[model samples]
Target: MNEMLLAAFALFVAYLYLPTAWLSGLRPAKPMTRQANHLHCPENKFYIPEDAVLRRHFVSQLRWEIEAALHPRPTDSILQRHYDALVTIKLEQRLADMGCLKPC
Candidate 1:
């Protein structure tokens, strides 16, 4: 019953936000260019540049701040922590793949 109520509320919220978000001129990002490929790894298929990932995470944090201002949540938090954790794991894996016990 709680799950069903949550699902219905989530769907209603999405329906309300979809048109507002569309009207707010928020659109999907454009494709990255060939010259700007260092930010991503096509071979392994993930974001590669630590700086870019951090920058994106920072921007998202700011977005969450704005959202929190509009609608004050009891616990206002962004997913940057999770993003950083994943990035750390990915960086360690890449280092391991390159035969380094520790990053130089």
Candidate 2:
């Protein structure tokens, strides 16, 4: 009786844990891809508080990044300024794309 119980438990464990390829045909999984048009937040899904500190915190980070791009380290070569300008341009373009900044 003990041997029969052990065999049953082993069979149960194998069926529960083993990956059987034949079961794949029952339901094939597909990867989910985002639709190009639905990139922006779905109309009011979340509400961000209009706190002054929070606003200043986010603005300060952006300001610091622009400032860093505008002024490279003294040890860097003059060519680094050109790279910085390109970085700034790309940042502005992305901000424009996200509707955070208005392009002239």
In TM-score terms, which candidate is top?
2
Native-to-model Cα distance after best TM-score fit, residue 16 in candidate 2, in Å:
16
- Measured with C-alpha atoms, the lDDT of residue 20 in candidate 2 is 75
Can you give the TM-score per candidate against the true fold?
0.24, 0.30
Scored against the true structure, residue 74 in model 2 reaches a CA lDDT of: 49
Per-residue lDDT for 7 in model 1? 100
Local lDDT at 59 for model 1: 46
Cα error, residue 73 of model 2, in Å, equals 9.3
lDDT, residue 64, model 2: 69
Clashing residue pairs in candidate 2, if any? none
Error of 2 at 36 (Å): 21
Candidate 1, residues 1-104, lDDT tens digits: the string is 99999999999898787776674577667687664555433344333234767757844654555445442333424555555555556555554454422112
Q: Go through the candidates in order and give the clash count of each.
A: 0, 0
lDDT of 2 by residue, 10-83 (tens): 99998788687756766678665553234465432322225779756755566567667665544566767776
Q: How close is candidate 1 to the true structure, as a TM-score?
A: 0.24
